[model samples]
Target: SDVIEFPSSIGKVTFTHKAHQELLKDCQKCHASPAGGTIAGFDKDWAHKTCKGCHVEMKKGPVSCKECHKK
Candidate 1:
């Protein structure tokens, strides 16, 4: 089947609808365009660099290796 965004990627990341809905009070909170102000949404300036950028700023980006992969 064709992937929604990146079809040629190694594999598709499955979504946990119920869990996400329960976890995230607002979809726009995490999924938004450049008009919402969050780097996840707006693209105005460095102020809003999105989750990845924000996390990186906090020394918590995925590149940290231990942020989410800690044992």
Candidate 2:
């Protein structure tokens, strides 16, 4: 799917796969090695670390609670 929604207690996080693919152009960045399938350890901390960490490093994307976790 182009867009994936993650339901959370704080809010629903809507992720645009196509956008990231176009921007990063690397499946390994978010996927597993060798083939790009399910992530190894996916969880809240992992998301905050990998996803938000990337945003922080790249100086783009949402990095705040309200920015990602919408009510």
Candidate 3:
């Protein structure tokens, strides 16, 4: 999917899958297998650590709550 939306109490987190794929150029970065399937232990904390962490490290993505969690 181009955009993956995660609904939460705060707001809906809109993930731009296509954009990440274009930059990373490797599905395994987020996917468990090259085939691309569900992440074994995907959750909020994991996303915050992995996704947000990547954004922080790369300094090229949304890191704030309002930036990601849209109402």
- By TM-score, the best candidate is 3
- Against the correct fold, how does model 2 do in TM-score? 0.90
For model 1, name the residue pairs that clash: 33-41, 34-41, 34-42, 39-50, 40-50
The CA lDDT of each predicted structure is 0.39, 0.87, 0.92
Task: Report the C-alpha lDDT of model 1 over 1-71, residue by residue, as the tens digit.
Answer: 12112121333333244454465456564556423332332332322254346457656434332332333
- Spell out the clash pairs found in candidate 3: none
Q: What's the lDDT of the predicted structure labeled candidate 2?
A: 0.87
Better of 1 and 2 by lDDT: 2
- By the TM-score metric, which is better: model 1 or model 3? 3
Prediction 1 global C-alpha lDDT: 0.39
Report the poorest 10 consecutive residues by lDDT, candidate 3: 28-37
TM-scores, one per candidate: 0.31, 0.90, 0.93
The reply for model 3, stretches above 4 Å from the true place, is none
Best by lDDT: 3
Clashes of 2: 0
Q: By TM-score, how accurate is candidate 3? A: 0.93
Question: For model 2, which pairs clash?
Answer: none
What digit string (tens of lDDT, one per residue) describes model 2 on residues 1-71? 78888889999898898888888988889887736666777888999999999999999999998898876
Give the residue spans of candidate 1 off by over 4 A.
Answer: 1-8, 31-71
